[model samples]
Target: MAETPIFPAIGAPAPDFDMPASKGRQVSLAAMRGKPFILYFYPKASTPGCTTEACDFQEALGALGSTGLPVIGVSRDSMKAIDTFATRQNLDFPLASDATGAVTEAYGVWVEKTLYGRKYMGIERATFLIDADGRVAQVWRNVKVPGHVAEVMRAASAL
Candidate 1:
């Protein structure tokens, strides 16, 4: 029900958004300036694919974390869901809830998805690599689950 992000080019400005984070704090994209950031949009917290993505990031935290970048996960789930997901998976990164789907819209991850020939609105698993200057450096849309963190880590290290 929202517009997809126009998806700024590799060197274009990363869209700025503020949403409720897993820690109950407001996270604004601008506040992340001066450091590379991983903005991954998922459909819901605790789902199979979503959980895999979060855990992969968690498992690779040593490499990605060493880069001094923030790995932020966004979803349309609520704080309750995010809390449980983080606790259950022992995820180390912050999980933000975009209940209204605004942030997902800004990032262009909210779109129609197909499952068993049924089409409905959902969050596409996607990741955005925002550089230190708040520009989009790389983007992985409609992401597959396996080895995603390795790919993202490789991209982050190159930045």
Candidate 2:
């Protein structure tokens, strides 16, 4: 049996990351230093759930940005796929490609999952809200799409 992954606790420093993102740019923890941000992990690009989540974030971007909390989506998909998805969704926020799974694992979103009695390893739908000091302020795991962005926005607004 695989050991359960441990997530970074609230108030802990967020794991660092540097990944290729849409619009031919790099999204990294270093670049977001001294700034609050949202890092959301999704299972795949262009999938139903992921699409809804991405689109919701896009729609809420202006409000979230107003709170000084930029959002970044991460997935194990390749850059090509991420770029295509971002373009299709008309997303202005960065959707980063973690082709190597390093960032996902570091953040503890990579885990064992079972569907219809079939077990597999996959990225869990999770989100982390990191404060300006680089500490984790909030976390959501096994996230349900409906009303999720609004919940995140509320937490960010409080920060």
Candidate 3:
């Protein structure tokens, strides 16, 4: 049996990441310091659940931004795929490509999953709220789409 992955605990330093993102950009933990931000991991881009989540975030972008928090979505998809998804979804926030899986693994979002009796390795639907000091403020694992963005928004505003 595979060992369960351990995630970064609240108040622990968030794992550093530098990834290629949509709109021809690079988003790094170093650059995100001094401000709280949302880093969410999804299994794939443009899928049903992922789309719902992304669109929800997009709709809440204004409120989130008002709190001085930026939202970043991460997936193991290629840059081309992520870029296309972002464009199609009209997402203003960055959709980062973690093709190498390093960032996902580091965040403990990469895990073994079973679907229809088939087992595979995939990225878990997870979110991390990192504070200005780079410490993890909150974490949501195996996230469900409904009302999730609002929940995150509330937490971010409280930060």
Candidate 4:
């Protein structure tokens, strides 16, 4: 298991990362520093909740982008999985595969979870909002997909 940081504290610098993107490009958090960013970490690519979240963001792409806040989805799945998920769903934003769990750990979302009373390690679905000055604007951990992007937007709009 990777070493995950404690839950990212709001008002701090968001932990930095550079992971493999679905488009074969490795994106660094630094590259997105000048604009608000939505960095969401999910369990895996193409899974039910993950897909719903991705699609929700996809459907809200225009609205979100119009606000100048880009969304980036992260997961432990491979780039192939991300590619298939994006093509199949026609997702407009980038999806990064955190196959090594480095980014997950950095954000503290790779955690122990319980399902049917069986505890195991998995991602705790979460989202981070980084503001233009590279500060951690907000952190949403243990998130549910429904209405998440809207919540992020609501928060970002106030930033």
Per-residue lDDT of 96-136 in model 2, one digit per residue for the tens?
Answer: 99999999999999999999999999999999999998889
lDDT of 2 at 138: 99
lDDT of each: 0.86, 0.95, 0.95, 0.86
Model 1: per-residue Cα lDDT over 1-159, one tens digit each = 444557667888998888887766678888898999998988888779888889989888887778987899998998999988999998878898888877777777878888899889888899999998999999999899898889998899999
Model 2 weakest lDDT span, ten residues long: 1-10
lDDT of 4 by residue, 88-130 (tens): 9888889998888888888889898878988788889999999
lDDT of 4 at 133: 82
Writing each residue's lDDT as its tens digit, candidate 3 over 29-146 gives 9999999999999989989999999999999999998999999999999999999999999999999999888999999999999999999899999999999999999999999999
Clashing pairs in 4: none
Clashes of each: 1, 0, 0, 0
Off by over 4 Å in 4: 1-5
Where does candidate 1 clash, by residue pair? 5-108
TM-score of each: 0.93, 0.99, 0.99, 0.93
Cα lDDT of model 4 overall? Answer: 0.86
Model 1 spans with C-alpha error above 4 angstroms: 1-5
